[model samples]
Target: MKACDVCGKKSIIQKSGAHRYGGGWAMRATKKRKVWEPNLHSVKVTHDGVRKTMRLCTKCLRRVKAEMAKKVAKKVEKPAKGLHFCFNKSIQFF
Candidate 1:
């Protein structure tokens, strides 16, 4: 059984339904034809010191994106500490 890399949980259920994607050739059908496909999304997953890719459900991907964004925002908000020493040195040197 395949397992989720982030959550480490095996898929609780088999995913089923129609799937549509961009950036590729598309095939459409009228009432004369019907196509049933599975819902899947591309994900940039990092694991085991390497970045590998796999298909994921939309819900999981969205949550991962939000979490990554939050981490980045927190990192940007915290300021570096070296400026205090630089400022004091400049003031005394002048």
Candidate 2:
């Protein structure tokens, strides 16, 4: 029973119907049990200066990647400490 490490996603059991061809009014509809598993992928991630391998579902993986990208973009967008950024504003005297 493999599951995602980040989200703890696991397999689910469900009932499914059998295929019916043409006009099969006399044929009975058979029900069967089906197993639905999450799409898990093995990925390596670095956190807190430590590298680890984990199994992550598609949704979690996408979220983690997006967060990492945001961090990188934020770092790039930051201005230097000595520089001041002033937006356009009208002069006000009080």
Candidate 3:
């Protein structure tokens, strides 16, 4: 079986946890209220005699866990010059 290139661990089970939508929508509108997310953890797994460990980020290790990381990254990096999106426009919400 192929092993992890970076961690040298075997195939890992991609563990994921809850990620509230728009920070539960309250944070999006009020910007003061804070929604909570749990710590996401990736654990090693051995199934049917196969062994592996899923690679995870530091956020999963400590910070608020989220199921969607890449999508968040993209949204956070949206350029100010990009297409102006009206509030009513159907945005591709992560």
Candidate 4:
């Protein structure tokens, strides 16, 4: 019943086939049932100044981290207020 909060990723049942080797070749194939579970982790995320705990998958976690890093980089790259350069021009009346 564990699922990712961001993408709704959940566990699923997968059907796999097993092959038996007799003489270096597959002799018989057997069907096997297995459970495929998503890697979920409990993480704290802040949204709109509100922090909450959520169950997130690894992919989503990486995406969130990347987004945060991008935001930080953007902030760092911006010029400070009153520190920007401006070009002055003068026009002569004809």
Overall lDDT per candidate, in order of appearance: 0.59, 0.83, 0.48, 0.83
C-alpha-based local distance difference test score of model 4: 0.83
How do the residues 1-94 of candidate 2 rate in per-residue lDDT, one tens digit apiece? 8799987999998976656562674245666788999999999999899999999999999999999999899888664565554566544333
Candidates ranked by TM-score, best first?
A: 2, 4, 1, 3
Candidates in order: C-alpha RMSD to true structure: 11.7, 6.7, 22.7, 7.2
lDDT of 3 by residue, 53-82 (tens): 765444443322353465588688655554
Which digits, one per residue and each the tens of the lDDT, describe model 4 over residues 1-94?
Answer: 9899999999998876656454543434565789989999999999999999999999999999999999999888664555544465543333
Per-residue alpha-carbon lDDT of candidate 1 for residues 1-94, written as tens digits (9 for 90 to 100): 5555455445444333333672243343222333333445668788688998976666677788899999899888664544444644662222
**After best superposition, candidate 4 residue 43: deviation in angstroms?**
0.9
Ranking of models by lDDT = 4, 2, 1, 3
Error of 3 at 7 (Å): 25
Model 3 poorest 10 in a row by lDDT: 31-40
User: TM-score for all predictions?
Assistant: 0.42, 0.64, 0.20, 0.62
Best prediction by TM-score: 2
Candidate 3, residue 90: CA error in Å?
Answer: 85
In model 1, which range of ten residues has the least summed lDDT?
Answer: 22-31
Candidate 1 clash pair list:
none
Q: How does model 1 fare in lDDT?
A: 0.59
